[model samples]
Target: MITERKIDLTGLKCPMPIVQLAKLIKELDAGEEFTATADDPAFCLDVESWCNKTGHELIRLEDSNERLVAVIRKKISEVE
Candidate 1:
């Protein structure tokens, strides 16, 4: 079974949300997924780009009313 850790950044801006995600994701083990909620539209692309650059997996990007939900998987290894 897989468990998800949810982080809400509803009122946060672009870099802050992504920056917070970077720190939070570092605390999670590999294979674990994190769901980040934000109201900043830029976060969708920013988060995706950040994950791509860092080699973490982007599982999903969805919109729920006023919030954008980004699901990211922590990389299994840091050897990249």
Candidate 2:
């Protein structure tokens, strides 16, 4: 079964949101999904880049109400 998780980074600034995301990702198992929500304008770009660099799958990204949400699936190879 796939596990789902959530991390709220709203109101946080650059680097911190990404930093916290990195930490959260590290604790997840392969095939799990996590949604990270943030208010930082740069979160979308930063997270897209981060996911690309780290080999995570960017499942979906939603931008609305001055908030940014990224749903990511943990890559099987990256779980270690």
- The prediction achieving the highest lDDT against the true structure is 2
**Candidate 2 lDDT (Cα, whole model)?**
0.90
Q: Give Cα distance to truth, residue 17, candidate 1, Å.
A: 0.4
Q: Give Cα distance to truth, residue 35, candidate 2, Å.
A: 0.6
**Runs off by more than 4 Å, candidate 1:** none
lDDT by residue (1-80, candidate 1, tens digit) is 67769999888875799889888987899989988889998887888899889899999999777679888889898974
lDDT agreement with native, every candidate: 0.86, 0.90
> In model 2, which runs have C-alpha deviations exceeding 4 angstroms?
none
Q: Summing lDDT over every window of 10 consecutive residues in candidate 1, give the lowest-scoring window.
A: 63-72
Clashing pairs in 2: none
Q: Which model scores highest in TM-score? A: 2
Q: Give one digit per residue, the lDDT tens place, for model 2 in 1-80.
A: 66568999998998899899889988999878999999999998999999989999999999998899999998988444
